[model samples]
Target chain A: MTTTQVAPAPPGTGTDRPAVAVRGLVKRYGGRAVLDGLDLDVRRGECFALLGPNGAGKTTAIEILEGVRRRDAGEVLVLGEDPSLAGRGWRDRVGVVSQGEGAGQALSVRETLDHFARYHARARSTEDLLAAVGLQESAGSRVGRLSGGQRRRLAVALGVQGRPELLFLDEPTTGMDPVARRQFWELIRGLRADGTTVLLTTHYLDEAAELADRVGVVAGGRLVEVAPPEELGAALRRETTVSWLEGGARRSVRTQAPAAVLRDLLAVQAEIPGLSVTRPGLEDVYLRLVGATPTTSEGALR
Target chain B: MTALHATPAEPRGLERLRWAVADAVAAAGRDVAHWRRQPAAVLVAALFPVLLLLMFTYLLGGGMVVPGGGDYRDFLVPGMLALAMVFGVEATMTAVVTDTARGITDRFRSLPMAPSAVVAGRCLADLAGSVVGLAVLLAAALAVGWRPGGLVPALAAVGLLLLLRLAFLWMGIYLGLLARDPSMVVAVQILVWPFAFLSNAFVAASSMPGWLATIAEWNPVAGTVTAVRELFGAPVGTGGGWATEHALLLAVAWPVLLTGVFAVLSVRRFQGLSR
Candidate 1:
């Protein structure tokens, strides 16, 4: 948080710089603002998860940071350069795994990686990249024939082939099976271990809890709250629920003093059956911030 | 912790050019692989003009005659060659639209590659395919008793045909970027056939009505058709007026103009995607 106060320097000249820093970013479509004066900062070597509901300007903010969309007003310094005007040198340092297919349908996995490798000055080997993404077996298969998970893996491979310092993953595991998703988490963990900065956007709250060092919740086109997952839950005023079975009926009470309630219950009962204490989890805090009904399936916190 | 690596400096000057050319060739190689994998589609694209040549020469040729008292096959062969190049617009448009719909174009745009390399690669691939397609049509014409009078003019005629194809190539790219999907491309393709037939590719412009002939004579396809027919020693009717008489000038002018306009439009549309 202290790092954001420092003024951004010229491209490639800043010391102790955040990987991505934005101040008062704004974007509009036909007089309606999609990104309305938002601010965010992602420190180097940290995995920052941006969580938001649909139409909450998450994609717009990410695209502006990636230099794919022009922001109407803002001071954005991504990797020490204004992304909107960054040259190829700056782009080489960043990688993006978009929520879209790769560039070639007829091209095999190897061919596709090789083609993208040429874009960077020091690209990783296609063989190693394929192995990293677990697509070595499908290296010879056309992209059109690969399953959805395989294609997503291929997209990640292409993103990291340049050994980028910053990687942007937008809904990276949308169609992957549970096992594949865990495997992807391990891959991202490896990238983080290598000191690569990752900025992730996902609807999955568990994913955000599991991967992010800090989570920023965006709603109504602005970041309403940002903190570590536990802190985000603690910041919310939701009461802890203490429940137990007493006299053949279940009894429940919401209270801020759940610990005292549990102590009194324990002092009264020699053996209390089916006793449980439930505090607000990350999902509850996220739902509260986004102003959504907890029962809604769309953009589920889980 | 894994070691963090800094991005290497960008390639400068000659090295940049080397990388750009290599990337462009890589893109073209993708088209090569596509052709290898889908040889059937390539064959169909290459042979479609031959079917048109045969249908016109055998079925429609019997009832039609050249305006200047010559073989309809001779006039039709050169004109069909020009028409074949024009017909390639649909194929190029279809490929571009498919790429866009499939999100391939957007992927390419997100990379750090040379901005022009992808389009350059696409143009090179389609142009190479057009050249081969022209050769196949030429062979069919030769088998049907058409002959070139001179080598130099024939080569020049081929150049003009390819130039015309290149112009359509940009137009296709522009339309492809504008189109929503392959279905939209199909809708546009239906219009290409009707547009192709209205030109002076089959019959002489002079043989049509005064107003129709004037419009047909001024059709960009008419310039290439007339220019190629003249170069191939086929009968070119005496369609008067500055536009028809100066067919060669228009042949060159039309492609250059179209290329200038549509290439700008394509690049603008491409760059505007981010905006």
Candidate 2:
């Protein structure tokens, strides 16, 4: 039964049909709501990043959208079909790089990708996929023998081998080194350019800022805010910090306009030594947005 | 790349069946690859029963008496074959449990392949290994002066042994799915040894205490062992009860019943897996 619980449409779910849409999604575990009446929409050809702290239902929400999980109540549509009712065709259209390392340990890299490729009607060539993930040299290496980052890359290669129209990446770069993470970002960029809709969840603020077309801040079992990363950063707090050294003391002022404060300071003196102006970064805003609850603390960021 | 973007329609009827068979075959190949990668482990598992056959036939056969006054080696050979069938449960259990705990099972579930393919493949590979193990054990039995009665009955005995293996395979799958860790395979192994010994696999049920004899005679392993011994014309008329008297009937029925109960349970457990 595809229970299309007609929730009031989310803002800006305009004419272009979303690749994924969920309405009033409620999932309960042991009578506690992991996802409580959450609504989300990811537009076609856009990177939608879902951000939340640990145990905030990001993985649960992703699994439901991927059609591998059942929601207690709500409407969910992935690729225009209810995920619960979706079949192999729907599965073909979606690729999931889950948080856990799901690769078969005994299979070599190329063999693993080749095995998964057969499940899809059409799949990218193993050579191309291996090269894309920079794993061509390790194609003969067993999955268990690969380093953590290499295994993650192999997983991504498997995820994209089918050339899915929609992709779900759950912490895809969790164990990647900086260089590998950047390489993975390039792969994501390439996928996005090819018009694959992506819904990603990650704890990394910079990943969301670097890749997301729009970012959603999930807190208290719901998305409290969804917007582009810059707008999200700005909307949470507009205050800018202007700091300068004066008479052997450091003075800092928070204001809406750093330029005005700098001008005022310049009017009184020739120049302010060690002067700098900065706005709250994505990490700071994310912390304040999802960290407003009682349990939110400095350790939450860590 | 453009062609790859298109989603294939859901397979229908014969196409779906074909895909399911192909998926299962591929899944079986995966397990075969595991065996190939670990040839030593596979060799040991396959040959362990032969070692036991030698130990019992030579070391312990001196003190044993056959019910019908025949060589105990002939009697012990077929019994060991049945015991070998029963022993495969541990291998199947460990493989299934490790797959579940390692996330490979979940990965298979998430794929577009047929839902039944994974278990079907596992059954295929395990049964194939059991067949090989039987062949090796039987060859060793022949080398040690055990002669078969007829080709047809010997083949029938082998069939019963395989059927027993298939029945235990389902039980193994169910237990593996129920276990939370691969360490539970040890518990299964420990329990299986006692279960095997308590049956007529290594001793005559008639020699046990009255109540123990009844339990041993009724054991599924005992049924297969007794049935195969009759088919191979090694020993017979070791009366324990009506069930023991009708060994062949019970042998067939035991496997069918075990497969029915445990297959249902394994399927239910598989379908209930949310992770």
Candidate 3:
């Protein structure tokens, strides 16, 4: 297959450019390339979702951007600075909410947040952070004693307490229940409203659809596609599936234009029973982009 | 949300160092708080060495003989101090392993604090725990008539024992980072027992076989034991053996060398952890 290459731009795009930029980023473990020359751009104040299966190098890419892991080859910039060489001031502007529960099991929720607040010069107050995460009722409870959802909320609160310009949330809602997940999404939206650029990785397609302004689908150590949710399902737009029952018999038709097909169906009968028209969802488009069996491995992390 | 607060007044060099030290102190405070919540674990760890000292000094002291003429408790006390330092390694190992398992180390990595605070905090907290253990053991030893020759020598003996503890702290940090599982700390603990026993902790090297005696005299634990003995004015063998002749030097050298090797290895391991 022929690969088209884009020309590189001159240095210093602008002070008000994207919050994060990655060009030709490559990472390898032993001989296996986890990230095969990836490129990504996350604009300021946008909630960008990175969708990938397990082992698709999503975590590796995020860690490199967070300055926790080094990339073998890349021109990566986070918050207008090279992440690999970013200093402590750069680190202070970036907050990371990782996959696991945080430390300080014995520390109470308020105390844990209070301790972390000291590490940052412009951290939010502990009480306000607790209320934001909906953990005010459990402020005095030890972190070890809280439920998994509460712990994850506390983790998110800690991540944002420093008032970072950029925040990376890696599987942030992994253990949250439906209500908690909705609540967390509101909290993320709040952050975006406050001009915090959020780069999120999640297995939940619904979550990405609800929170992300744009989504990037990664598979086989490569970003296969990136676009808005509505545009991503465009592949399935050419063919529409219509299902209905006529004369007690089930009937279905696939057509390029659903409007034309509906007109024809109406001409055949005055009214059709149990009629329904369906278009592919973001999950369908995502699975097709990643080239996997949509039923079995729709959101499986590669 | 609050307008970024005017860049927050960048800290100076000394201020940064002070922040790092404060971070370590806060982490150590967290560990102390955990100990307070689980007092049983601390009690067991702190009192075990003291109980062993009592059992040995009273039950086994009468039968044991030093190379030079002296009461067994006087000889036993210095060795016990060295034993206490060795014994404390398990606590350090366990604490490090537990922190790793609980994702505490990963949490520390994500924070924007000083990089060395995690291990440094651990060493400081473990040192505090060891000091408590040393004090209890010393009290038990004193109760059993284990007296130093003078006040100055007793203080010197304590200073040497603390030095040995500091050395062991680094060793423990290295081992803790190297071990993958908390259960591996048990294996490390078991390994420490042989190193302690093979030294001149429980008996005189001269009373053992010639080959074993040679090994014991050269053992790093033996160096600390001999140095503490000299500090406490305990009996040093009349013969110009290797341990008595170079007691002070070996005491300092053993800790320095062990700490150097382990400290370098620990820092390397810590860097490798990001991988």
* Cα displacement (Å) at residue A200, model 2: 1.2
lDDT of 2 at A111: 80
Docking class of 2: acceptable
TM-score of chain A, cand. 2: 0.84
Q: Kindly state the number of residue pairs that clash in model 3.
A: 6
DockQ for the candidates, in order: 0.40, 0.37, 0.35
Question: Per-residue lDDT tens digits of candidate 3, residues A73-164?
Answer: 97998876676665556667789898877667777898888877877768999888988889999999999999989999998998899888
Displacement of residue B234 (Cα, Å) in model 3 is 2.0
Q: Tell how far residue B240 is off in model 3, in angstroms.
A: 7.1
Q: What tens digits encode model 1's per-residue C-alpha lDDT throughout B26-108?
A: 77877877788888989998999999999999999999977768889998998888888877778888888887777677667
Model 1: how many Å of interface RMSD? Answer: 7.5
- Best candidate per DockQ, number? 1
TM-score, structure 2 vs. true: 0.90
Candidate 1: TM-score?
A: 0.90
Per prediction, fnat is 0.51, 0.40, 0.39
Candidate 1 residues A184-238, lDDT tens each?
8999999888888999999999999899989999998889999887788564545
Which is better, 1 or 2, measured by lDDT? 2
Q: Which residue pairs collide in model 3, if any?
A: A53-A301, A53-A302, A54-A301, A54-A302, A55-A302, A56-A302
iRMS of each prediction: 7.5, 6.9, 10.0
